[model samples]
Target: MFREIPTVNRLLQKKWNDKDQQIHLQKLKNAKSTFNIKKRRSSSRRISKSTSKKDKIQEDRFKQIERDNKILLQKMRRIMKNHSGVNLPFEKGSLNKGMRKKQLADITLANYQLLQRLQDKKSNYNVLKWEKDRIDNKKLAQRIGIFSSTMVDPAHSKSKQALPTLKNPRESTTRMTKKRMKKNYQTELQPLEFPSSFPKRAKTTTRKRKRTIATPEEDGDKAKDLDLAKVCSIPEEREVIFQASKNDGKKYEVEISQTEDKMFIAAANKVKHSEHYLIELEKEKGEEILKEFNNNFQVILDNLKVISRRLVLLNPNINDPKRANTTRNRTRKKNFRKLNKRGNASQPSLRPGTVNSPSGDLMGVMPETARPVSPTQNTNDLQA
Candidate 1:
């Protein structure tokens, strides 16, 4: 019985050992399953957290993009409104509609490109302008077809036409007086001795009567009747002039002379008239003289008058005391001193010389000696 009981106990121990081992294995499986589930949950939590942060960042970026777009749109709207009146060359229909976002962006990019191109064009335009200016300056210097004040032709600038000559010539009047004389008689009455063949002739006597001379008026009328035009067909004198001058009241005599170069005044002596009668004639002659004078002479006379007036105005002495006082206050004077000359103070100096003294104290002197030459035995030195 005791041995049997011992075997049963061994069996029971083995059974217990198997059951405990089973339990241990089951616990290890359960723990492994729990660990796997915990690891999966932690991984899911981390992924969800990362996803939430990414969503928030995307929302902020979207809001920022919208704000930037609104600002840019406002600026574009202002630009569009200000420049609405300006139309594109070929897009007249597009003027009534607002530009699309893509179109606005495209326009902005195009504007940027256009600005760059414009800047480049402006620089090139400036360069071209400078080059053109240089070319124009060169043309001006070369006296090309360009018309500039500094490059005017010398011939065109100077006047080539001469002034006209005086139309009227000046002249004068003259007068003459008549005179008569008588002579004494001493007659031999016999013919001057002429040698003949020795023949004597008796003296003969005859009665004679004096003839009366014709009056000046009758002779003048006769001369008038003569054909003077036919008789003097040719010009017999170098110069001929006919003039008349008044002597007494309403009395004038005509004169013909050959001194045409003496002008109208050549008849001045011919006009032996009263003062009142001569006054009228002198006035007429004076006007004719002025009419015949040279233009250059008139200009010279005008300039002389102006210069004389200026000299009178600038004279040191003034007729008015107020002007003299003003002049004295405005005038300035410089201090000057006379130099003390060494000798010949009264004599004027023609030139500076060692023996002569200077004209004024302004003179200065310097000591100078002849060039020194060494004595040589050669004849060339003596010649020098």
Candidate 2:
């Protein structure tokens, strides 16, 4: 039975080994099939990815080429426009460094020439204008009698030569007097003939008096007193009355009284007639003075106006010949003259042959008569 058991165990072991071997083989076949399928799928995916990448690269290259072509076209058009009339090696293209520098130099030279021509024309015009102005000024000066024919030449003018030698009248007189006095003094000092028997006069000497100083006792007695007066007793209240006169021949009273506190107070029953009269007098005096001042001021103003009118008529801005000839200035001056004439004509005239005084009165005329006449008329009609 033990030998049979060994055979049976061998047979079981063999069968189990066969079953295990079959299972392992089946697993290997399944694994090989799955691996082959996976490898085929991977290869197809790689092929598709490579083809797509190539197509994208080609598209990008074509787009970049199109952009570059557009940019080049724009540059070509700009170069053609800029170099239109310029003779260059490239007729319709951009210039190189040397060509660009040559073109800039040519343009600078043309600009410089144009500026020089303009300056020359301006200088010529200025010269002509200056000559004309010089002639006009000479004529104006001659007409005004400011420059005579001979006086036009400064070197020939005697006044110009003598101006440096001229001295103030008072200074010259003083210098001449001093010189004569010096001569007289020198002549007087000459030795005078005298008799030998004449007694010699003694020279008297003068002594200066000295100032005296005050002693302490005298200074003490001379000290100033600054003490206030003392009151002995308080007095009873008393009223003092004052009367004043007015221009109307009326009298008013002012009362002054002493208070218990030693203060003196003044009270008026009514406004003082004298104060009103004084105030009225002051007002009248002030008005008279103001009237005199106004008359004098008006006389001066009229004289100034007349003088300014004469001056304007004489020269009319002779210093500036250019401004004097403008149409606007001429019209303005005409209007001013018309206004002045109308004002002068409208003003009342003074009595014939009456001289105007600075105090706004006519000489040899009563104040009443002068008061009726305008002060401006007398001054304006007086000719130098």
Model 2 TM-score, 2 decimals: 0.15
TM-score of every candidate: 0.15, 0.15
Q: Write the per-residue lDDT of candidate 1 for residues 257-315, one digit (tens) a residue.
A: 23323221121212222111111113343333334333223221221111211110111
Question: In model 1, where do residues sit more than 4 Å from their true spots?
Answer: 1-41, 84-384
lDDT of 2 by residue, 1-384 (tens): 123344557878778778999999999888744354442556888999999999999999999999999999998999988886656574565548789989999999999999998875633355656776777787876665433455654454445334455667775467889899889655444433444674656676687668653222323222222111111121344332222211222222212223333322121112221121101112333234335334342232222111211110112232246655776445544544564666752332222211222233222212222212234334332321
- Candidate 2 lDDT trough over 10 residues, lowest sum: 305-314
